[model samples]
Target: MTDATLAFAHGDPHQLRGMEGVGIAHDGPAPKRIVTGYGFWIFLLSDIVMFSCFFAAYAVLLGQTAGGPSGAQLFDLRSVALETGCLLLSSFTCGLATIAAGVRNERWFQAAMAVTCVLGLVFLTLEGREFASLVARGAGPTRSAFLSAFFALVGCHGMHVSAGILWLLTMMAQVLAKGFRADIQRRLLCFALFWHALDIIWVGVFSVVYLLGSAV
Candidate 1:
């Protein structure tokens, strides 16, 4: 190209965002892992924003029982505690899986991921049972504003967990087929980030929706 064009390109301040230095630029696109992680982080932030709205709705409608049962009457603390344990254990195993991925240990990665998936399944099962019991008691979402908000907030988190379980299995399948290829590793990293964020959101659910709601 011409010197003037090159000068304009090299001197453009906007280009500095992608360049390592003022004049020098990366030879190719950003590393796949970094780009993948950044994109997934944005996805996570958007998910959090969605959950924040749910939290606000639940908070506002917390006391709107409409003459039906409320959280204090419907929530089974024992079941919720067990579900929390399962998720916490799954998160731990997920961390181990991430470490195994970093070390390129196929066996440990598969085993840890399997354990995480099982724990997540157990969590979902317990949550499903709890919802069933509530519905059987005529305390379904349509029963009251409180029930609707409660179901929306908790069910959103449960849906994320369900998606995470699916993603974990997909990651496992790809690892077996691809054997930790760079792209697969980046996907695994994103999976870890997504799973951990779910756990964080669940903690909020436990604290605000369960603990506080029960007391109120």
Candidate 2:
């Protein structure tokens, strides 16, 4: 082959090998994605610490009824059962949504995510109504130390669920706009972790505040 033809066939040498002297700039001191993930982990750890403290406080205040309604008098196991089922189903839907994202099935992802969010909202609504009814019946947080602990522990968990719903909605918007890109998928996974962690905490609350408390 002629020299000119050979060079044309090869194309730009640097281009073929990849960009030269581009020196892929580090966006900042730390890689943006790695730093973001590390920061999220730290936040989750801090949350764990907070939950631990709440758990300890609840334990200490477990039997302090102060002449008010005790867990056996106040807790409705049937309602708690329903709430637990709903939250568990929501967690399942969230998993399905993540799977849909991985497969790049936008419709399934959106549908599953919407279902998850709806279920989460339902759980929160039920919890709020339950709290309201209790308070209306003169069993509010101020009723006794036990009630106060109950409200704080369970209420904090409900707040986490609320925050998670918001986060899920935000991620849904991102997915709709950008489609399931890697970064967005990662964020969704993290949100899933957070959601499931809330479920775990609820299990503990249910056992300590409802089941065991009833037995006592």
Best by lDDT: 1
- Give the top-scoring candidate (TM-score): 1
In candidate 1, stretches whose alpha carbon ends up further than 4 angstroms from where it belongs are 1-29
Location of the lowest summed lDDT over 10 successive residues in candidate 2: 19-28
**What digit string (tens of lDDT, one per residue) describes model 1 on residues 21-122?**
545544788878899999999999999999999999999999999888878888888889999999998999999999999999999999999999999999
Worst 10 residues of 1 by lDDT: 15-24
Error of 1 at 172 (Å): 0.8
Q: What TM-score against the true fold does each predicted structure earn?
A: 0.86, 0.81
Q: Per-residue lDDT of 64-95 in model 2, one digit per residue for the tens?
A: 98988888888789988889889999989988
lDDT on C-alpha atoms for all candidate structures:
0.91, 0.85
Clash pairs, candidate 1, are none
Error of 1 at 51 (Å): 0.4
